[model samples]
Each structure stands twice: as C-alpha cells, then as structure tokens.
Target: MLYQSFREYAQGAAKIGIGLGVISILARWVTGITIFASPEALVKYGIFGGIGYALMGAIALMAFGWLGKRVRKEFGDGLTIGDFFQFKLHRVGYWMMIAILLITSIEGLFTQGMAAGVLVNILFGIPISIGMLCFFLFCVVYVGFGGIVLIQRLAFVQVICMFAAAILIPLYFFIAKGVENVYQGIRLYHPYLLVLNNHEGLFFMCTGLFIGFGQVFVDQATWQRLYMLEGKKIVPTFLLSGLIWATVPLAFSSLIMVVIFTGSFNNIYSLLFDLIRKIDTIFLLVLFVLCSFGAVTSAFGAGLHSMISLIAGNVYPLLKPDANERQKMRMGYMLAIAIGVLSIVLTFFFTPTLLELLFFFGIIYAALIVPLLFIVFSKGKVDNFIPLCALIGLVAGYTSRYKLGNLDAVWVSMMVSSLLVIVHWGSKFIKKQLGNH
Candidate 1:
C-alpha cells in the first residue's frame, strides 16, 4: 500500500495478476445499485427485463475486453480514461469529455450512496444522513486515501465474500423452499414473468446495448483495470470478469424471487421488505446483508479512487505542469474527501428511482457510444468535431425528453449521434476520393 510516486498511487506499485484483476472488477461492477436495480428490473419488465439488463452490462464488459486489447497495445502506459481522451482529442474536445466524465462519475457515486443509505436504514434502523456519512467517510479514508494498492487488496477479500453470498444464500433458499413449489407459486401470482415472447422486454434489451457500450467505454474505473493488469491479461481478464458479473444479477433476482413466490407484493419496495423478512436463518441473513453492503463499499471505493486518479494523474498536470509528486498526491487526498462529501449531499437530496437515474444518464451514454467507438478504431488523432456530435445529441435528446419520454429520448440521442458520425466519415471519404482523382 505504500507508494511514493503519484503514478504508483494512482495505479499500483506494479501490475496485478489476472485472478486479482477479475475479482477487483467484480467488486467494481456488482454494486449495491446493481443488487437493488436487478430485482427492480425483474419486477418492472418481467423475467426478461432482468436478464436483458444483466446481458447489457455483460456484453459491454466483454466487448470492452476486445476493444481494450487494441487500446493497451497502442497506449500501454495510460493511467485513466482522461489520459487516453487527452491524447486522442484536442484541448476543447478533451475538456468537453472531461465534463461529461465528471458528471457520469458523480452520478455513479450518487447511485451507490442512495443504495447504501437505503440498505443501512433497512438493516440497522440508521438514518439516511448518518448512514451516508459513515459510508462516504469509510470509502474516502480507506479506498480513497489508500489508492489502488489498498483497493486491490481489499477488493480481493470483498469480492470473495460477495460471490460466497451470491452462491450460498440462493442455494439455501431454493433448497429449503423447494424449486417446484416456488415455480408454481410464481405462475399462480405473477404469471407475466414466465412469458417468453415479451416485445417490451426485447426492445429494452436492444436499446440497453447503447447505454452499456458507452458506460463501459467511458468508465474511468474500468480503464484503471485495463492498465493495471499484465498486458497479455487484458482481454481474458475482462472477458472472464464479464461472465462472472452476469451471474450477480441472476443471483440477486433469485433472492427476490424467494419472497415473490410466497405471495403477491404491493411493489418493488414491499418486495424488498419481504425479501429481508424471508432471510430467516441468522447465517443466511448475515450473508445477504454483508454481500449487499460489500457491493456498495467496493463500488464506491473504486469510483472515488478512480476519480481521484483522474484528477491527480491528468487534471493536475494539465493545470499545473510544475506540480511535484507530493503536491499531486496531496491534491488527490483532498479531492477524494471533497468528492465523497459532494456525493453524500447529492444522494440525500436526489430521490429518483434507479430506473429514472438510468434513463436520465442513458442520453449521455447513448450519445457517446458511437463517437467513442469511432475515436478508438480510427488511426492517429482525429477531429475535435467528432466529440461535438455528443454535445449536439445530448442537447437534442434532453430537449425531446418531455415529449418523447425518457426511454425513447435515449434512442433519439443515439440515433442523432450515429447519423452525425456516419455523415462525418462519409464526407471525409468523399473528400479523400476527390483528392485522389
């Protein structure tokens, strides 16, 4: 955990092994938000809704593996997504992206904070503010100040506990309750969940790809894993991580099912209450609580640490080229505390549902996916105008949001950005052909 250089602090003392990397990523992705949101998705759009949601994230992570191999090959010594974008983009484009990234990063911490707040309140009867204060302080003190070195070490232990809970609790539930009885109960009460040919579910799955692509692509936390591993391990580590992560939602969704099968619930909130009640055995109950809490802790820590890394490794250098390593590290510690406090305040005030948060951010994710893909796949530095497409699409999408609804607005944003990119490339090709003639 000891490190002198800012690089060492932001990344690690050296590269990590595949096993550590995969577990660290699992810790990073399977957040309390993921635990809460998965079950909610199952309730909203039926069984496929939950599966599609998991598929979106899994596909994104797996595809990131394929794309990241190319990224690391060309840009091997990167520290954060900020570094990569700065290298690829002009000053304007880079700053624009930094703004977008900053928003998404905060939004990410917000979700975790909200989930953690609710979790503690339910489990321990703690007030939301007190719970959030403890959550934020812990993350900043340990993961934030300790940096990647401590994060990786702690991630190994946390991920192990998560997988243990994910496996054992569900197995116990199914075994005790009987799978056949559970299935019969579900069919008798919530029959739509059993239906396969759900058109809304299929549409949701398809649109989810755009959000997933941009989310994984622009994620600073995921990018940290890319550079923190052995060069040869990049693809397989991420590929394996995605496969492992996909199982998390399934396990969580099943945990909720244990409650759902007993009788009808009023809504997702009541279902959560019932799920908590259903954890009858003390061992199973402790396992479930720890798993959910660990999910929040790991995700929050990864996010807070990565944001600190971005500021220390990239932003500080951009602003003050003369800053020494000690100064950069100091700034990072301060920034971590600041960011954690900001997340606490925001999470306390913003009371949107997880789905609302997803759709709200979906505009940004959808808009950026295509342009970012083009930027990565292209040779050398490209136009700053490429990044502008995201801005235009974002404005267009938000404007249409009230009229078109949040979900459809996401599609509009993606479509607008995709068309712009096509035109940009098409015009470039035409100009090149004319010059050749």
Candidate 2:
C-alpha cells in the first residue's frame, strides 16, 4: 500500500507535466538560503560574490544528476545514501561515512535554522526564536504526517510563488529606478561589488565550485528526489531545475543591488527590512511574503522529510533489521518531530551571519568532495582512508584560516586533503605489492 501510494504520487506528478515538476524542483533547490545568503554575500563580499554564491549552488545541483545516476545504478532500490554506503562499505568505512553524513545533516539544520530566523525577523518583525519555533513546527507536522506526497504538493506551490517573486520583485525595482540608474547607484555606492575579478573573489568562485559539487552530489534531500521521479524524467528534471534555479539567485542578487544601491545596511536582516520598506506596491509585498515563506518551508520540509527517511531507513533498521514497514514509518514520524525540535532549539543559541555559516559549512563540504568523488567514481572499493584524509583536510584548512587568512583556507584545505589522500593510498599500494611478491 505504501509503495502503491508512492507510485501514484510519482506518476500523478506527470499529469501536471514537466513544467510543474520544474517549478517543484526549483522550489526545493532554491531555498531561503539563496534568498537570504546571496544578499548577505552582497553585503560582505561584493556583487560578484553574491552572484558567485548563487551560481555555485545552481551548478552544484546541475551536476548532481551524475552522482545520482551512479548511486542509483550501484544500489538501485535503497531508500537513502546511508543505506547504500552501509551495504557497499565495510563496518569501519560505513560508520565513517555515516558520521560525515550526520555532521552534514547537523550543519544542514544549522544553515536552514539561521535562514529561517533571518526571514522571520525580516518579514514580520518577529523574534528569531519565536519565528524559528513556528517554522520548525510547521515543517515537522507537514512532513511527518504527509510524507513526500504533501511535501511535493506544497513544493509546487512554493516554487510558483518563488519564481513569481523572483521575476516581479526585480522587475518592479528595475522599472522604478531604471536599469541604468540602478547600475549607476551600485557603481557609485558599492563600487567594490561591481568589480568581479578581485583575487579573493576569484578564489572564492573556484572553491565555491568544488564545494558546490560536493553539496549537491552528496546531499540526501537531493538524492531522495532522484528516485522519486521516473527514470526518463530524472536527468531532465535536474537539468531543467538547474536552469530555472539559476534565475532565482540572479534575481535575488539583483534585488539586493536595489537595496544596497539605495543605502548601506548593517546586516542582511536589515537589508531585507530596507527592501521591504522601499517597495511601493502591496502586490509585491505579498509576493515577497509568499516567496519568503515558500523558500523557507520547502527547504525545511525537504530537510525534515529526508532526515526522517535517513533515520528510519538507515539508522533504525540497523538495530532492528527485522522491523516491519509500519514500525519503520512510526520511527520516521517520531524522528521528524525530534529533528524539528532540535532545529528550533539550536536556532536560539547559535546565530551567525548567513554567509559566514555557509563558508563554515563549505569548508567541511569542500573536504568531503575529493574523497566522495574518489569513492563514487573509482572502480571497486576505493581506499577507506580517503575519507579520513578529508577529515584531516578540514582541520588543516580551518586551522590555516586564522593564521593564513580566509581566502587562503579553502585552497590550503583542498590541496592538503587531496595530497594526503594520494600519500595515504600510495603507502598502502606499495605495501600490498611487497606482500604479493
């Protein structure tokens, strides 16, 4: 019955055709992070950095299809990445992989929690803690009870609202200020943003690309979407999603330009408030509200649901391998509520600016990219120590951040980890050759 329900959801989605699917995909991928973080990037880095941040995510998502195809082909029927890793890897390796996944999941909560807090503070003048609680509660209930069916149903609505906002918000601003005037304002007030090729900016883009690849490639939420679609639609769904997803960040970044061009703001939330006040049209304000809500909720819902699937399918089953389907479902629902509560609690205590949080998470993700790619693409079992090398890389890169500086950390981390992986494997290869002789 559960399988039948899943089949109906997947196929029934086709009745709306690819357009709706594209919108749903857009909503799922283009979350509050893009809405809040891109502008935050604009405030801190420059206009180019803002656009780079957006581009990185879109590109990451576009390339994830390759990873998805590989994963599905290897372990076609598995429900989660953790499940696939458990079957393919040794106990030590599997635990190591799950540890990384769990860390990423925690970071995912942190990221979304920050974005939710910022949005709530922006839209309604609500306290971040109160707003976060409401956001988490909504996500937990919708995802836990409705499962993927309702998540996707609301994702379609979310995406439509997001795209409408993306197009209309910028269009309204561009019309008001005129493109030439907006450009002049950016150039005059925030000239640093206008310059694209600063050395720090260039390195940021390169590292961002690597980090982007890892994020989309390894993310469980994205992986869940892979199997949820028809095999034929799988590639196109991701591809079109990427294309449509690109416009959103660009639009949001440009909207921030409208904000920054007008005057300086102290923080991202303040910039959002400024934008809200500056807009003349009531329709646009409502659109902003819908877009903000949709972006936050789609991401929150996907995270909540995907995390539930991970815990139930991957973690719970380990202790109770013989558990029935209903038992698994019950565990999943409970876990969904637990994660939501944890996210709300976490939001209250820790608050970092959205871009800082993104880069902080980016370092860990960047470290994992080399090892994960090696594992996925290599023939047969790649060396287990590769992931361990990544852990070392994250430490080394971060240690260097204060000593060497921010831009340099990404490079140091990537190079150190990649080189260590080679050295670690080389020693093992040489030892094995001697033994064979």
Which candidate number has the best TM-score? 1
Per-residue alpha-carbon lDDT of candidate 1 for residues 7-109, written as tens digits (9 for 90 to 100) = 8877877798788889888888989878888888888788887898899889999999988988887788788998888878889988888888878888888
For residues 1-437, what per-residue lDDT tens digits would candidate 2 score against the true structure? Answer: 14333334222333333565566567667877888887776666676676678778778777776676777677666666776677566677777777777777767766786678777787668988788887777776676667767877788788778878888889889998899988888788888887766766766777777777767877877776676655556667777778777777778888888887765668677788888888878998988988887887888777766777777777777879998766776787786676567766776677777677777777777777777777777666655677677888888979988887655677777788888877876888899999999
lDDT of 2 at 408: 68
C-alpha lDDT values of all predictions:
0.84, 0.74
- Note the clash tally of each candidate: 0, 1
lDDT of 2: 0.74
Residue 113 shift from truth in candidate 1, angstroms: 0.8
Query: Which segments of candidate 1 are over 4 A away from where they belong?
Result: none
